[model samples]
Target: MEVKIRNRSRVMQVLALAMFLSLVWAYAQLEWGVPHTVKRNVLQSRGSILASDGSVLARSVGGQRVYPQGVLAGQVVGMMGETDGLEGLEAAYNRSLQAGENLKLTIDPKTQAAAEAALAQGVKEHHGEYGSVVIIETLTGRVLAAASYPPFDPNNWRNYSAETRRNRPFLDTYEPGSTIKGLIVAAALNEGLTTPTTTYSTPMERYVGGRWGSTIHDAVPHPPTLTTKEILRYSSNVGMSHVVENFAADKERAYLSNYGFGQDVQIPVVATATGRLQRPSEWTDLVRVTSAFGQGMSSTTLQLAAAYNTLANDGLYVSPRLVEGTPAGERREVIRPESARTIRGLLQAVIAEGISNAAGLKGYALAGKTGTSQVAVNGKYSDSLFDSVFAGFFPADAPRVTIAVTVHGATTNYHGSMLAAPIYKKIAASVISNWAAAPQQLPKP
Candidate 1:
């Protein structure tokens, strides 16, 4: 009987040892291929994404899909870590992307390459705090090239500095400066409160009721009487407020809504931000005038690009989408078709004769805006420091791509035209050069 009990005990001991071994193996299964960076439940095999030339842009080689595009696609291809910031396309399309199945992205590799090169050059020349470039397909919402300075290399992701590695295009919000005035222009025209021909009497600055007067001024003043188009071209803060204030708060709010403010875009990465647009009920007079000119307002770079895409699509405002697979190719119209024409015409004039002239592409007609705003330091707008931004599209008559750039903590004048425009032009030129054939005439705004 004792001998029989000993045998049973030995069998139980073996079972316990087997269970412990299984638990250890299960824990190992959660680790990534990289020994040091053990992410939880990280798939050993993600999938394949091929470039236009059939070369692999990314794949599930050593477990997780490796981003060959490197820093160029960083923000869009965000890292899945313990902390969340610019969790770009990779995190966004993770489940849908798996081994065996391939994700055919719409991004043109040639364009992406160009964007990276141009941004690098710009950074080298300016050597600002940091910079970012985003190239988007106007017809489809595919993000072609999203590059940032002090870029993050996915190979050694943990080594990248947190601020330098962040995908600034979609994650960070800044004062959009005079760039947001485009929406005010659209709102005024849409509400029938003003027309392209509407006239505004300009003073360099005007008064608001608060301790901070509502008075608005120009980045550089020129004329006293100007048309709506001229006001936009000049990016006149007072002029923008003149038209915006003429309408009720409801009217202005409607325009911003149509422009996609207070909304997040659907992109691959989960790292996205919806810029804070004070609800009409929450707006004050002090906020109103500046908001018209993109001050007292905040926006992510992607949100700004989406708005410009409307003009690129001839007033068709499709919700921005980013994913891989066979999804619907249809677009929903957000603005009247003809309204697009009026805005594009004015925007074009700005590129031709306004402050953002440096952003003009060589062979293509480009339409875009430039903005420079004081980033709040010590609770006040500091002249010494500014955020520079350039947002626009190529072939103004019909745009295929939209490129937006932001330079943070620039030491130069930091105007959008002078700083950011050149980067967009370089990227556009590079993309156009590599196309197999001339693109079809894009839909005009």
Candidate 2:
């Protein structure tokens, strides 16, 4: 009887062991198998990103994300990671993209190509560390092109550095130098403080910020006296100081803020810099003078383009848009239409009569301003390094497109008029040709 009872107990122990083994196998399968299947299914179902013309910018195939137009608007389209987007628009709208929804962009492929080509040539020719070009449609604020040089190839993004992958138009910020002069001048016009023909005694150098403060100098030799129109044409730093000399600091900050400086531009891209604009309380005489000429302040290339677009759009500030189906950007009257028109006319004169004549197209009425700001190294401005910039709009009488260009750390030919202006011309010419833009009669200088 005792032997039979011991045998029954052994049988019971074996059955328990078998049950434990089966449970372990089921748990292992649950841990490894189901998630793998779901991941595979998710990747296979990932959606595509399309340009405005339905050309595929990014799409998933064979469980991999592919960029058809390699290095073409790559930074703007961005790249996907092992399981998600890593940067740019991909990252901006990752959730919808992962859910198998298509993201359509406002980027025009031909315009993007033209901008990239022009920017590449200019940056290479000038030996710049990097550069970016942003083209915004005047009326809609749709970004036609946003090109960054040393282009990032989404297909091979791992090979490039973060700097190369950076969308400089949105992410990078620099003191815009004299480009801000146009905005300041527009404010002066709005306030009835000055007119296009108003005159200021613009010496080559002046102590507008008081003798103990920094002395401002004009980039090029100009007359001791210059009209407000000529001040813009010459891009005279000293003249900018004089224009804003009587302009109060709080009011200046208000105008800049109204124009989108120091304010979030609310672009879809990640980490778009608002670009530093100090409080009015921080404004000293020297700071005010420097800010007038685009020092003591900084702005992204997109912000600069959009500000010029406000002038192009007849005083209406349209927030720049990248993704389609997104709500249209905030539109507000930043300045009086008359004041905006006056600014455009003055900028047109700059292209026609100033050093920016290189940007002029034979038949198209172009308007723009050039900026060359010394780069700050450590804590002080570096004499050797500079940021060359150009901001302009085409068919100035009735503008359709606004463009902003920047070449950073150029080794030679660093002036905005020398490098950025010509680049602007090349891009504008290509765009005009691509669109077969009608020729407008150039206004008399």
Which residue pairs collide in model 1, if any? 76-89, 78-88, 88-269, 89-268, 89-269, 206-215, 208-214, 341-445
Question: How would you encode candidate 1's per-residue C-alpha lDDT over 1-445 as one tens digit per residue?
Answer: 9999999999999999999999888777656334434432244445565554455655554545466666656555556443222355555555655333566665566776787778777766776788777777888777676667776776567887778667777778888887777766765676676788888898778776478565566877669988888888888887887877667766566666667777766554456788888878877766767778888778877778877787778777665555445453346566676777677777777776764347654345678887888899988989788888888887777688877788888786567767777887777667767653355533322
For candidate 2, lDDT tens digit of each residue in 99-176?
Answer: 899999999999999999999999999899999999999999999999999999999999999999898999899999
Model 1, runs deviating above 4 Å? 1-44, 51-54, 62-66, 79-87, 96-100, 209-212, 326-332, 355-357, 435-445
TM-score of 2: 0.92
lDDT of every model, 2 decimals:
0.70, 0.89
TM-score of each: 0.82, 0.92
Model 1 root-mean-square deviation: 4.9
